[model samples]
Target chain A: MKKIINEPGKFVDEMVQGILLAHPGALRTVGDDLRILARADAPVSGKVGIVTGGGSGHLPLFKGYVGPGLCSAVAIGNVFSSPSSQQVFEATKAVDGGAGVLYLYGNYGGDVLNFDLACDLAELEDIETRTVLGRDDVASQPRERADDRRGVAGIFFAYKAAGAAAERGDSLDEVARIAEDVVVNTATMGIGISPTILPTTGKASFDLPDGEMEIGIGIHGEPGIHRGPLETADQIADRLVGAIIDDLSLADGDRVAVLVNGLGATPLEELYVLYRRVDEVLRGRGVEIERTYVGEYATSLEMAGASVSVLRLDDARLELLNAPAQSPFFREVSA
Target chain B: MRTADLNVVARRALADLVGYADELRDLDQALGDGDLGVTISLGAGAVIEALEQLPEDATAAELAKACAKAFANANPSTMAALVAGGLLAGSKTLVDSTEPNQADAARFVRAAGDNIALRGKTQLGDKTILDAIMPAADALEAGSDPVAALDAAVVGAERAVADTKALQSRRGRASWLQERSIGLQDPGATAFLRLLQCWQAALHAAPAERN
Candidate 1:
């Protein structure tokens, strides 16, 4: 309701404009309609294109991941809405380097439908396309129906692995297989301490009383599995890490990458506090931390919450995760 | 009714949709992201604007195609995409008809509902828009007069909207709420009901002889 914007209707467009302006050297708008964001040097000849897309409210996600070692392009949509199939096709066309393209994205229904439609369109143009859906949010569905789970911050791991593989000139099937493997090995759980207001409606998507926390809520403020009084940072970390570890069946001496992602409004200091607990919990369980990302990697629009994602890592995944990548939002130092 | 009349009816339905946008937003806020109202209105506005550029004598299929493109382009939300897919599918049923009658209207509604179900992968009891749209399509199929059929469809949709309060969502964002989504009207279903009511009202407001 109270935020910085010229017009609620133009929020997504203006945001895209700002992002392009801020990252002029790294990103550019593509497509006939200019609805897609691609890496400045997209269409890398012979390299398999990696593309992802979703609704707009989540920052540093579909768009922010478009770069040298991340997604080659992203089809952008309105806030909390999927991009049109035409837009997706444009992104596919913009990134296709003749080998093929892989569509990596969350498992939301809208994204699924639009991306599937785009694949069909791309087929008409003789461009091969494969899809790998990210379903790593443990809270959306039970483990038995893991395919139905929503993709949260855990998708960041998939992006890294797939992007690195593609950047190394891996074939589309190989890149997609690697991405799917990452999706299967990753699990994420989030806790919402407060609700966010939709910009257009200027109303809270949902209500959370002053002193309550909802564990397992999605980025859109969907109701979580459990709602109760707010707990301490350690307790919150225990619940999130405990759920993810249980779902993943992580054993002692296992190696994993941890990402403590802030949901837009949470402060970095608070995220680090949560990450500290996550580190302590993993250490106590004998799980080796291969790498750690504690920051606002993916975000909802000003939602006060955080999510913890753990990627069970093997040597190949670790190698890819450590590969050099640079985007405006995500960066991995060359090792 | 004449094929030209379809454009007028679509315009009226869009106006009603734009008018009820805020109400739909409030309903969605209870169970899902509160963007349905704006998304639907934006889609409708695009359709209406596109309709303005169409020839006065355009066939029902052409009109429906324009609406399909407009809705899909203006709003890419799940609900909007489903609606756009439905319109595209329904247009196929009217392709051969120069002036579709009540029977064609019935078939259009049924085809639209079936396409939405297929495209969205949702069924009657999924607590989605299909809950209202499927029943309304059936009701429309049972009647011969356009006005009466629309009236029947509206009643059926209204009942389905109320019925959704007792059902749990199994599709789209509302499904995330699980049991908590119970007792809240499915926003997509409510919007479908409003659309039917708007169409019925448009049918009634027109001259009776043409219908």
Candidate 2:
């Protein structure tokens, strides 16, 4: 439970306050509640609002993605807990322009419950909204039960694509359709070598021995589908990327975008090592890699692991991916 | 009644509803995490306060939306969220209405019940709040007279609560108890019944009973 902080109870608030102070002109809180953060120039006149929310631990995740060409607003919750429906509604109101709003986030139960309830509140305010869940974690559920899969780092692709559509003033239905299409095309799998200690309880989220690795682990330290002794970086990449590409069913000459993400404790260099193997594997399969991102895009708190996500891309999705995006933790220049 | 009467009656009904919080809490402790009592008490107080601030010219839809926001924000639990969502859904039925009647009450309750059922993913026999809510909705729809409909609602809600004692828990935390939940009173269903009873008493009791 050793970590840097003031009071454990004040961890989320203090961190958020620091972020607001550091990036005053870029991000701002909606209304009086600090839990809801929106782009400074939010409710962008006529663009469809994309509001994403989830727990707090995953930095650069639900919160860091709020900026121009990304999510319009975000409702943050406590570490590993869903935000209240009221918080979600406030974010909805904060980012809702004349065009409708969209709720895009990972597929988690508490999040689903709170956001769905927020939809009702939004309707009462005469604000139309649609929802597209990120269900890209291939290890969480089988293809037959894909809807039941948990969302992981692959949601970044959805955010980028959906945000581009909204930036171009796409209708609410079009934005949601684009987001859902990205979610369906994306596949993610991770391997965990360690676990995280929850800030509130100061307890480990899970237990794993020093030399063992958890295959198909979720960002919240959810148990993986399989566990065994640790393997080399290439071996780990093979397991994760192998599972993802297989799930994606990538064909020869088909194009895909890859994300090699570090789960908290894993270093960037280690991510590159994983990406190198991933590159070889995809190239060997005769699949064309159009775009590659290798870094800490999503992470569990202090968990030692990395995940590989593949988005089977077409020209439209590629163009959307290439569109300009800017956030506190993410940025992309227009092609 | 006009929307003006809606404010006073709703506030009064919620004030009475808070009185049953302890009873609901005790029932929930037997089958759940034992927060239902506080959730109801806090939610009722919040709604009552919110209704107090609404102007005399407030519409029927405004009344329900205010209550929904206040209740949900007061104690942002799963129960609070579902109840607030139900209220918001029910408010849609009154969007065009000013002076709501008995038939309008039925429509609101039915919409609320249906919304809860849809959001909670529970059926009528799930021994949840919806168990009592749906039956009370049916009772409200069956009556033509306002007073009789209120009485019928109380009766229907009570029967649903009683019937829940024979059914295993099937939704929310209570369902985690599995078959062991049988023979115990359901907290959510009982809360709905208590709500109806409170509404009935609010309509019938003297103004001095607001205390």
Candidate 3:
């Protein structure tokens, strides 16, 4: 509690102000609402615009994706809450080009309502709109109807594909289709070792035993499907990859891009350990790993856990996956 | 009947809360993340700043609107959003009115409870802030006088906080404790209850009636 802060209420505002101050050229806020985080040169013309939004605590998911060749705009909600319709509408207006706009985000209910509202507003403004929801978390719901699953780190893949499609001058409908395809091919599963603290309540979102983990935990502290004794790095990875593979119906000889993502408090060393095991599992299954991304692509602030996302890749998808993407949270390396 | 009329109460509650915020968070550091103090302080600060700029002669509900706006704009964290959700729920009960009656107050309390349930998915006995908040609301609704109602709420909340030690942490960080959390009162439940007690005492002693 000795941390330096002006006042608890001012933390987000001050933090938002500080972020803007630190990167004046990189971001701009819409009016008094801090939720709408947009690119500096927003409202690009002739090219389709991409926008994403979600709760605030997951730093890089919604806001961090707003940049060149990524999301043109992002509407940030409070931790675990969806941004208001007005915030989404403002972001839509800001990012709308002569070409239509695409509303790409998770399948959370509040987000669905607000983004739907934004789409209505955009239509009124003569800006065409398409939406692609990312629901790749197999842990949340069953795979027979995976659209009900929550979107986790796998959303980063959809963002990349959609952003690249928009950059390539594809229409908004084409971009939305490309993003939806990625979502369909993607599957994710997470394990939680610890819980996140809710800043306002100053309490943990959930609890775990010293030597146990909850498998299939949601980022917003939703109860996981099961809890069990602590397992080694390889064991945990095996469980996660096994669930994802089964959920996605990946057959032998399938190819994919792998993302081993940490849930905030998990260290790179541990993530790499899981990554190694996952690599082994996929290789053992004869699944070719076209690309591998390891690190905190998305997070549940300070929660100790990790998630695995695999997107079954075809040639076209692989090309888009290999395309260059630069954001505060992502970097691409040329092969 | 204007929002400005409630500024005195808002400022006093907020200032009083700054101390409570720091204290609550400090206590939470023992078992929680220690954000309660700072987040509440930040929320109060937002309201205080908003109050200073609001037009004079506003009503209690108007003042409440400003508070809600400040919360919506400033504190977007999950915890803040939960608090804001409950407050907004309460405010919605009186949005059309300039003042509050016992029925309106009761409606506000119920709305707050519902909002918290929807936002946090917490139930009583989960050793969450609801352990204190729900009973407090029920007591307030049943009390004869507003001050007495709030006082009853304070007592119910205090008792609930004490009983939390026996209950398991079902929702947040305390849940991580698993079974070890049995002996410790949830830091969030305690701080929130304590703040309410303080608010009741101050409201009982205030010179103006918030008319």
Candidate 4:
């Protein structure tokens, strides 16, 4: 029930205003409604545009990924809600260069509907678009039903690959293919020991006993697969990395990138603690760790937990991952 | 029917359908945020005014487009925008037609229904507005006479609304309720049914239909 804010209703708008004010050169509002934001120098002539969005409260998630060599635009919505189709269309229109646009976003019901509607609207304006959903949360659905799994931290890998492809002037179809490939190779699983308090309600997003943790937790506090007494850091890492390994079927000599992400309230030291165990488990299995990123890449407000995302790397994906990229919340300098 | 008179038919039907706005609001209250009634009432009023301003020689496609623009501008709700987009997509099937016949009515309704399904990421049994629309579209295409087609459409849509009562919602806010949403009449499906019945009544009273 305790938090810092001016008004609950103004939380999203104020946060967006702060971001716009803080990163004026890197971003610009696309539409008059203030719901859509695009790269400051968008419509890079002949480069395919990549538009990614979802609900708010997952800051540095949707809106934070808009800049050079990342998402070209974003349509932001309320906390844990889908943006309107018009907002999405506005973003598409603002960023579309001569090449077509790609809709890279999470797999959720409302977002899917709104984006598809925007695609239809974009067609009316002669702006071609392709879509690739981030369905990498292996805990939400089985590997066989990956298409239906909810997107989680693993989407960062997709954004990186797709954005780099677009910057290199890949055809719209090629960019889309690359995004879909990254999604296929990625898998994420999270655990939640604490829940977030929504700004409006000032109440918990979910309830759990004090000494227990929820495994396979969604960012929005959607019920995880199981609830059990809190385990040691190594055990937690084993559960998360173990599930990802089985899902992606990593074998000896397989190259992969690891992301140990904090779910809002967790600290950097704790993330590194988790990463320590992650490194041991992967190396023990003879998996070659090509890259390692540990931080709060995506978050669920003030929820206290972390997730692990593994992207099996090939030469092309590794190249995309290393390409020069910059966003407000993420960046990748030249090799 | 004369394409020029399409606006009049639409305006009259919309005005009549406004009578059920309160019922729609009540139904939506049980499932969603309860703005369906307000969206429809405001949208119908806006469309009525917009149709009044259309030129006497306006084509049916233009009329449909006007309805789409007016309805979308009437409210900021995602539902209104989606329905408006559906109307715009349906208008494409009328590309160069001067008059809209019974067949055109079937085509328009079915095209709109298909767009709503695809745009809404749903199918015939998703417990959204499409549940009522596709059944009505099928009936319209099956019937030979306009009057009979509308009658059959009404019956099909009514049956669909009743049948959907036992199914859980699969889209939009109602889906969040999971199994608890079952047994409630979907406000969206009901709204489409109301529109069909109003159109049927308006057509029956039209002087052009009599001729």
Best by DockQ: 2
For residues A1-335, what per-residue lDDT tens digits would candidate 4 score against the true structure? 87778899999998888987887788888866667989889989999999989999898899878888899999989989899888888899899997999999999988998888888667656699999999999989998888899999999999999999999999999999999999999999999999988999889988989999999999999987899999999999999999999999999999999999999999999999999999999999999999999998889999999999999999999999999899888989997
In CAPRI terms, where does candidate 4 land? acceptable
- Once fitted onto the true fold, the runs of candidate 2 whose alpha carbons sit more than 4 angstroms away are B1-80, B91-107, B122-127, B141-149, B162-190, B202-211
Q: How accurate is candidate 4 locally (lDDT)?
A: 0.90
The runs of at least 3 residues in candidate 3 whose Cα sits more than 4 Å from the true structure, single-residue gaps closed, are: A1-6, A333-335, B1-211
TM-score of chain A, predicted model 1, versus the true chain A, to 2 decimals: 0.99
Query: Which 10-residue window of candidate 2 chain A scores lowest in summed lDDT?
Result: A117-126
Ranking by TM-score: 2, 4, 1, 3
Better of 1 and 2 by TM-score: 2
Query: Fnat per model, in the order given?
Result: 0.06, 0.50, 0.00, 0.34
For residues B22-116, could you state the per-residue lDDT of candidate 2 as single tens digits? Answer: 99899999999999999999999999888888888888988999999888878878899889889988988997677999988999999998999
| DockQ of predicted model 3 | 0.03
Please report, in order, the local distance difference test score of every candidate based on alpha carbons: 0.87, 0.90, 0.78, 0.90
Q: Whole-model lDDT for model 2 versus the true structure?
A: 0.90
* Interface DockQ of candidate 2: 0.48
Ten-residue region with minimum lDDT total, candidate 1 chain A: A117-126
The better candidate by DockQ, 1 or 2, is: 2
Error of 2 at A256 (Å): 1.0
Per-candidate chain B TM: 0.94, 0.96, 0.87, 0.96
